[model samples]
Target: MEPAMACHADRTAPVFQTKGLTKTYRQGDVEVHALRGVDISLYPGELVVMLGASGSGKSTLLNILGGLDVPTTGEVRYQDIDLAGASDRELTRYRRDYVGFVFQFYNLIPSLTARENVIAVTEIARDPMAPEEALDMVGLASRLDHFPAQLSGGEQQRVAIARAISKRPRVLLCDEPTGALDSATGILVLAALERANRETGTTTVIITHNASIANMADRVITLSDGVISGEHRNSERQDPNTLSW
Candidate 1:
């Protein structure tokens, strides 16, 4: 294999980083390039928003960043460990220990209460917050006894967020976290993410197409055609409650 990409190689150890990351897949006789030479450095305790359209490689980058998938060519590093070059067992351990992911769908069990969902993850986590503590963080203390079916879209997503972060992960990756909810509901979910990032100092990256969501981030990264098109550093993060549709 060729040496790892050098785009961000010389930078200081970041919370998470990618150097010349690239991914391609074979579709019959044709090759589809999902990501093309992406480079980024995510700092600890920063909230980053990734803006991109469909087929723009946002999900591909997030997947690789989360250790859910490896790049075809590139170097992904978390602290001192090289993710791109890690073995399957190493990656599994990395994901289990360092990364927390929240997807678009809540994916909660129908029969499990909000607290139960959070506890499931805490049970396996090395050092985890109490399930009730996590629920409180998301402002769900009053709804902890409610099942998925008993909660609204926003509430269910908050449960998902609590479950992901109960382990106190070093990094949190969210992909279109608010895609399924209305604007009002979506802001609530975004608030949960912001609180987690601020309180725990977990480096958080959220992928979304909604420009309105960008204001809540410490930095905004724009991707197009599998390449980074723009990078913006917000002077100040916006309060989710202050955000409007």
Candidate 2:
């Protein structure tokens, strides 16, 4: 990894910093506040899990941090770049080069094989891993030729993860990665995420409603009513296999 590609290897230096961040959406005559005066810092290579109910600002905060949306007020800084003020082109470039997003849906092409799906992303990335290497990292080496229709829900999601990390993004943002799977399958998905983090040292933030998933995080952040409610750090992270919903 180049110096810029390294995901916050410097634990003391922040990869993402947000100050007094607020987001509001106008729905006809009403305004819905998504994030209100939120201040937080994410270190390099840290696995941070965000826990909150619906409308709690967890996904809103993640979207802002990932360059998918701009804040209404305050500041969002990814390193020294000011995201809140970045132009649409700048934000698009930022997302393409530095961010990897995984949603609840795998979004894999049904016609493409697993390897082909991963290759579609690696081809556009700078200093990316090969499609095979990426799948191997996510423990899908044996399933490379399998199409989305042939794989289980967890396996398909793993392919999504492989596609995301093949670019070697500095930050990995996952929203409800396991929301569509059962407990047994969810653990497998979480395990793939944990393994990717360990191998690539990508700064990972996962948004989840499951409290048990907190055990795998280096830090746990909570939000309520569009504001930060609490934050905590674990002395040591737990194995994903040991976690349950």
Candidate 3:
């Protein structure tokens, strides 16, 4: 959807906008095109779900949006910052200050407790929520002292989410946040994400291959062969507890 069609009436400028975005890599003699002229505008405080199969370029787009990578030939803007033309140092600062990322794997330090893991990011953030507050948002108030090894996979993932949101980032980018869990556990994780989005009002983008997850988003965009093939708006978001794989 265009930036003008924002779900929130107060939001005028898009948090992220990309035009003719492309990413190409040379693997031996073959040129693999991960993205091909993708154009999208993600608005502030809206939950967006990008549905695509394997190698459909969703992850590549997320990486570029998160400042982990840059587009080859396009204009990528995060508000007024030009991401496509940014230097490595600028990109680093952009990521640290404005973006929060959650991946399929919970990359929590094994030695750190849940609170400690969240503290690691908040300590460096310009403005941060208390570690307890973040964990409470995810329904993990009682597990503050548990280490990664002591927590279940879903619990560990929740801890990771707590850590990401603790920084109070303007945007939260999640790549397959529930990919590693079973249906029931995945719902819990999705609920945490939904809670985070609802409570914090962060512009959230979740990229996944599962079509069922689309019901929980304000907007759903499908990618095929590196381009956005379909886009739609959901009148009302379904609760994550009601969603099944």
Candidate 4:
């Protein structure tokens, strides 16, 4: 294992920061703790991979960071915005303007062409890339006219990525992005994400249980039982094409 790298982000302010973050959900008779005081920072233009098994609270953390949910306690800050205290409407605008999300499943519209699916998001974004450009970034230029059914699973996922990035968001959040794909197909998707981060300089965070995927990240944070267990920075990122799991 590589030794943990020192914090080099002090020169630039973090794009997102959290302190004493916690979330609790009530079930029929029990209260489940999803997060137990998570404190972290994400810098601009860095690729981070969070590793954890199911129920490790990675998804909960991602949802809060994306403004889809609020923490029960503690501060969640996105630059100068107080995400933890933001109103529903403010969070909506923050998600719309600054955050982009890609999920494990490709939620492409079956009725819409690949380009059209991406255009759906671009239309609502404040300042967006051309739908064609976003699709092209993910190596889907040739399949723009194809509907979801006409494309392969990997291609459909790429379309989803294109849709998320079309808004030119400052932060890109991916939740198990390659979870549904075979190793070969997953590599392609990871490559597209790497390209997007490099080209657009979007701060990217990918949450997955796959440890192999961490090799491509600038930093890797491990979560266990709703708390951060370890963290380390890679001296260099490996090419996604060379990764196998």
Candidate 5:
């Protein structure tokens, strides 16, 4: 293995690994390569931020890692399971059993109360925290009965965080989670994710264009034109409360 793709000498097996990962989308005579020969490993309980400009393959990488999409080439290993080689049934089970996702927009059901929305996920999980407890973790305990329209943007985002973590997924994949919120609100939403990572020891990966948010992560990976352009490991991560927007 190349030194760049090698795990730290002191580190154990990675929670996630990608080897020569590639994804290509065909359109008639043209082909768009979303990812090319990407090699990386992510350890457990670490918070990672992916920084990239538009068309940089950040979203594509996140999708493949989360089992929402499969790569055209290469492999993805989630612990002992090789995701790229998993059958559709196995992929479905893997997503349900191990992965959680958060996106820019809160996809809460309008008719359901905050607690109900969270319970929707817990109901399907094999082992899950109480919906009320999950909401409390995101600082939404008092808003349990409120519907989506009754909450502010940040509160709605918090509810979404509660939904994602209710199942206690081993990995959390967030894609532009704060893109739709104001800076102040975005900070709070980011804090919720940070708290989840710390409290549950869940490995977290966030994809963002906002460089300001990178300071809160233990490592940052920057991608350009479907390849990793830079990889940085921070010596210390600032508490989310101290992070600036």
Candidate 6:
């Protein structure tokens, strides 16, 4: 594994920092700007909600931060490492070591039990939490032996979360994590997220279309047309019960 660059900043440093970051995709004669000169920072152990409409570039930004996509211009640093300039292998190692991701779809293997699914990641991880412990963290202790087909949508999502977090990554990025569920079930997913963030102290960034969900974040950022339009902080977080749709 490549050694991480030395960090000059103290504990106040952000887990991720982007300055004038931009990403453009080319298809035939047209160019699409998914993100436009956006500057942002994700702090350690804070839950941030990225709220916006469909074309707002929230997912694009999250993808870049997660090292799945690269920007066409500008700078992005993961801690002190230069992510924007990292080679493919370096980026792969970075993602493998420090990043955990959850998406809208629950991509578990139908034949694997919840604990087995979590173990799949733990095996490859450098230093991971026990699969059973991870499942318990997401309130799936009793369902550890259940297959994905037998689990509800919310339960499946929790298992996914357990799988992602079992590696004990420094950052957890979720893109539309609850988009597929009804409100009541979605709250369970949100509660899982809240519990994971509080207990593990992992820096988490969530991208969602629901404005009401922003109330639960330590900070909320809104995007529009590929740029950040607004950012704010809530003095106190609202529990899942208090969060509206």
Task: Provide the global lDDT of candidate 6 against the true structure.
Answer: 0.90
- For 1-245, candidate 3 gives per-residue lDDT tens digits of 21122244125689899999999989999999999999999998999999999999999999999999998899999999999999999999999999999999999999999999999999999999999999999999999999999999999999999999999999999999999999999999999998999889999999999999998888999999999999999877888888886
User: What is the C-alpha local distance difference test score of each model?
Assistant: 0.88, 0.91, 0.93, 0.93, 0.90, 0.90
Give the worst 10-residue stretch by lDDT in candidate 1.
2-11
**lDDT per residue (tens digit) for residues 202-228 in model 5:** 899999999988878889999999999
With a 3 Å backbone cut-off (N, CA, C), the pairs that clash in candidate 6 are none
- Total clashing pairs in model 2: 1
Clash pairs (backbone) in predicted model 3: none
Q: Write the per-residue lDDT of candidate 1 for residues 1-245, one digit (tens) a residue.
A: 21211111122357887889999989999988989999999887788899999999999999999898999998899889898999999999999999999999988988899999998899999999999999999999999999999999999999999999999998899999999999899989988888888778788899998988888788899999899999998766778766767
> How far off is residue 72 in model 2, in Å?
0.4
Off by over 4 Å in 3: 1-11
Candidate 1: clashing residue pairs, number: 0
Off by over 4 Å in 4: 1-11
* Regions of candidate 2 where Cα sits further than 4 Å from its true position: 1-10
Candidate 1 vs candidate 3: the lDDT winner is 3
Question: Listing every candidate in turn, what is its Cα RMSD in Å to the true structure after a full C-alpha superposition?
Answer: 7.2, 4.9, 3.8, 2.9, 5.2, 6.8
Model 4 gets an lDDT of 0.93
Give all TM-scores, in the order shown: 0.93, 0.95, 0.96, 0.96, 0.94, 0.94
**Candidate 6 residues 1-245, lDDT tens each?**
21221211124678889999999998899999999999998888888999999988999999999999899999999988898999999999999999999999999999999999999999999999999999999999999999999999999999999999999999999999999999998988998888888888898889999998887888899999999999998766778655556
Q: Model 4, range 69-170, lDDT digits (tens) per residue?
A: 999999999999999999999999999999999999998889999999998999899999999999999999899999999999999999999999999999
In model 4, pairs of residues that clash are none
